[model samples]
Target: MELNSIKDAFDRVAKKQKLSCSKSQEVIDQIIQEIEKALGKIQPSLSDYKHVLSDLRTTLKDIAPLSQLEGTQKELNIALSKYAKVIEKSFNPDIAKAYRNIEFDVHTVNQIIAIHFYRQGFFDIGDCFISEARELESAASIKSSFLEMFQILEAMKHWNLEPALNWAANNSDKLKQNGSDLVLRLHSMQFLEILKKGSRNEALKYARNHLTPFSSDHMAELQKLMACLLFTGRLDSSPYSALISPTNWEKLAEELSKQFCNILGYSFESPLSVTIAAGVQGLPPLLKFMNVMAGKKQEWQTMKQLPVPVELDKEFQFHSVFVCPVSKEQSTDDNPPMLMPCGHVLCKQSIMKMSKNSTKSFKCPYCPSDVEATKCRQLYL
Candidate 1:
C-alpha cells in the first residue's frame, strides 16, 4: 500500500468509535499485564513477541479496512487503544499489573507519547522507549531516544550529573569483568568534562565521589578535568593532588599543559602553580610548561586572555638532560618540529616535514599558537 493512503486509513480508524474510554483503558491494562507476565515468565522461545505485539498495535489502527469479518474489525480498533496503555505500563516496570483501570486518555499516542513523556519530565517512560528501541534492535531508534534524553539534560542545564557517577560506582565490577575499558574511559572523560563546567558543589561532589577510582591510570585526563572543574567552580579544591605523587608531578604538569593547549588553544609553563592558585592540586605537564612559558613572555596571557603576542625563538633548548642530537639522516626540512615553552627543544619533526604539512595547524614549541611553519623560529638544537 502507498504510505500516504496507509496513514489516512490509520487516521480514520484511530478516530473511529470503538471502545469507550473506560473499556479501552481496561483492555490496555490487560495487554500490559500480559506483556509483564511474558517478561517475567521468561519464555524459552518468544523470539519475536514484542515485534509481533508492536506490529499488531500498528495494524489495529490501519489494517481495519482489509481485515475480514465483523468481530475482527471491532477487535482491531479495541486493540489499538489497549496497546497504548500497555506502553504506559512498559515504561514503569514496578507498576503492578492488577492496578485499576483509569479513564485518563492520553492526548498523544505511540512515538508521540514517548516524546511527550520525555519532554514532560517522565524519564522512566523515556527510558522505556529506549529499552524498547533496543529490544526491537533498532539502532537508529535507540540513538534517537538517547539523544532526546541528552536534549532534556541540556534543557535542565545539568550537564554534570550524579547518574553518571552512580553508574560508575555501581558498575565497577561489571565494567571490569566485561572489559569495558574504552567505553568506561569515554564515559569518565565526558562526565568529567561536564563537571568541570558545572557548579563547584556539584563538580567537587563528582570529584570526591567519582574521581577516586580511575585516578592512577587516567590521571592525566582526570587532572585536566579536575583543574577545569575547580576553575569553573565545579570542584571546591584540587582533590586529586594526593593521587599524583611528587615524583610524578612533572609528568602530571606536562599532561595538563598539553591538554590545556589542546582544549583551549593556550598553554601554561607553570600550570601546576596556576592549578594551585586556582585551588586545584595536580598540574599536568603541558599546563606546567605553558604556564612557565606564558609567564616569561613579554606579554603574559592566562586562560582569561587571548591573542597574545607571538614571538618565535629560533634557538632551541632541550629540557631533558640526556638529550642527544637528532641524526642528520633523520632530519629533513619537511620534518615538522615544535619548540618547547622555554624555547628549549623541538619535538615531533614529522608534523612539520612533508610538503604543505607545515600548513597544518600546530603549537609553537616556545608558545602555543595555531600557526604554520613560516611563523616558527627554526630551532638549531
Candidate 2:
C-alpha cells in the first residue's frame, strides 16, 4: 500500500473538516451576538416585553442563522463522505481473509516465547513460564547462559567492570577467533574508570598490567590513555574531554551484550523480534493478495508458497534466497531447490515434470547430461 497517498487523503479530509467546523462556529457566534444585542435593547417593563420579542424575531430572520448552519452542515457531510471513501479505498477492513486455517506447533511456539523472555533479561518471568509449561526443562540451560550476560550488564550499570573484564579475559581466545576487539575495549574502559577516581598511580599500574598488552594492536588508543594521565581528575576539562561522554559507556555496554550473545551462538536480536518485524512488513502484501483472491473466488489456502512475493527489509533477511533458474520460481520448503548430479540446480517440481513424474530419464535443459529425478538431491539453501 502507498502510505504517503493514504496520508495525503487523510490530511485533505482533516483540513476540510477543520474548515467546516471553524466556519460553523463563526456563523453561530455571529448569530448569538446579534440575538444578545437584540436582548440588550429591551426595556425592563412588561409593556415593552412583547415589542422586544417581536424585534428579536425579525433580527434573527435578518441574520439567517438557520441557512448558514445548513450550509455548514452540508460541507461537514461532504467531508465525512469523502473521508469514509478514502478509508475504504486505502485500507482492507477484513484482514482475516489474509490467512487460512493451519496447524501450529504449540510446544515450539511456547519455547520461542520463553527464549525471547530469557534473551530480554526477564529471567524470573522466563523461569515462571518454564515452570508452568510442560516438558520445557531445556530452556533452563538457555536461561543459564543469559544469566552471565545480565550479570556483566548489571555491574556495568554501577560503574563496575570486574565481571565484564573477567569474562573477557576468560574468553579472550574465543573472542579473537570471532575477530572481536571487545577485550581491549573493556580494558580501556576499566582503565579510564580507575583514572577517574583521582588515583594516578593506580591508573598507571592498571595501564601497564592490562592496557600494555593491547598496545601492539591498538597503540594509538593506548597512547591516548597514557596521555590522559597528565590531566588526572580533570580529564573532562582537558583536551580529551570527548572520552567523557556517557555515550561511550552505553555503546560499550551494548557491544558487550552483543558479543556475549554471539559467543553463545545466538543472534543479537531475539528470534521472536525478527519474526514479528518481518511479519509486519510482509502482511500488507499478503492481505492485498488475499483480497484479490477473494474477489476472484479462487482457492489459495493449500498453496505451498505465497502467490505474491513478500519483500521485507534487508535487516530481516537472515539467510540467502534462491530462485530456480529453470522454472523461475523461488524455493520453499515444499518445493525446495534440488541439485542434480550434473552440477545443475532446478526446482523439484520442474525436475519431476521434466522427468515425466520420475518414470523415465530426461535430458537436462541447460546441459546435454541425461538425468533421473530420483538422482537429484534436495539442497537446503
Candidate 3:
C-alpha cells in the first residue's frame, strides 16, 4: 500500500513537470513567432516599421502562459516535497539505532563486499576496491572460479554451448551424482540449434552422439526429440514444437548457474546479495519491534534475542533450527537439541533441568511416556 502511494506521488510530480515544460516551451515559441513576424515586416531602406514592432512587443507582453507555467512549476516542487515526506514517513531513519551497539570489522567486510563484486563479473570495480582496501590476496584466491563462470555464462548468452559442454563433460560424474541433467539439456539445445539451421542429417548425428546416453532416464523427452526429426525442415510446425520455446534457453541458463555454483560449493547468489536480501526482509519487523520497545521504555539492546520472530522466505533459510518447547529457548551449541525416547526434541539444558540434573526419569512434556535424560541422544541439524 505504501509502495502504491509512493508510485502515485511520483506520477503526480511527473505530470506536473511535463505540464511545466510544455507551458515553458509554448511561451518561448510564441515569443519567437512574434519576433519573426516583426522582422518580416521590417523595411531595410526605411525605419518606419515602429508600429509593427510595437504590436509584436504588445503581443509578447500579453502572453498569459508565464503565469500558468509558474503555477505548474510550483505545483511540481510541492509534489516533489510531498513525495520526499512520504518516503521519510514510510522508512524509519532511526532503525539504525538497533545496531548502534554492535561492532563491525571494517576490513573483513570490505574484502567480502569486494569479493562479491568480483564474483558478479565486475572485475575492474572489484580490482580497484581490493587495491584500495589492501585485500589483494583474498580477491585473488576466488577470482579464477568466478572468471570461469562468467566465461561460460557469456558464451551461453551468445547461444554458444561449447564451453558449457566442456565444463559439464569434465564434471559428468559429479553432475550425475547431484541429479543434474545439464549435459543432456545442453545436448538437446545443440540438437535444436542444428535442426533450426536445416541440417537434418547433422542433427540426427549429433543426437545419436550426445542424446543417446540419456535414453534410459529421459525416454519420453528423447522420444519427443526424435519426433522432431520427422518434421525435418518444418520442426516449427511439428507436434514437438513446444520444445523450441524461447523460455527454454532462459531455463537452461538458470540451471547452468545453479549447477555451476553447486560444483564450486558456492551459493547460486552472491553471499553479499543474500545477506542484503535477508536483512531487507527482516528489517521491517525489527524496526517495528524496536519502536514498541522504545515506547515501553524497555531495554531492547540488552535482550538476548528478539521477542518476536522475523519470518523470512524459504530461500533465506540456510539451515534447520530447533527451539525448546519446554524452556522457550533456542537450541545453541552450548545447549544442543536432543531427542528423547518418546520422539520429542528439547534442548539439552531443558531436559537436564526437567530431569533434575539427570538424577531421575521424567515424563515427556507432550507425551505420557516416561524417559530418562541419560537415554536422550543429541540431534544434529
TM-score winner? 2
Error of 2 at 359 (Å): 11
Deviation in angstroms for 231 in model 1?
2.7
TM-score of 2: 0.78
Write out the backbone clash pairs for model 2. Answer: none
Writing each residue's lDDT as its tens digit, candidate 1 over 293-378 gives 64444432223222222222232222322221342223333442445434544434533552155666655434564555544454
For model 2, the local distance difference test gives: 0.84
lDDT tens digits by residue: candidate 2, 204-223: 99888988887778899988
Q: Residue 47 lDDT in model 3?
A: 76
lDDT of each: 0.45, 0.84, 0.85
What's the candidate order when arranged by decreasing lDDT? Answer: 3, 2, 1
RMSD (Cα, Å) of model 2: 4.3
- Off by more than 4 A, model 2: 28-57, 100-104, 121-132, 144-148, 154-158, 295-299, 332-380
TM-score of each: 0.20, 0.78, 0.74
Better-scoring candidate (TM-score), 1 or 2: 2
Q: Best candidate, lDDT-wise?
A: 3
- The lDDT, on a scale of 0 to 1, for candidate 3 is 0.85
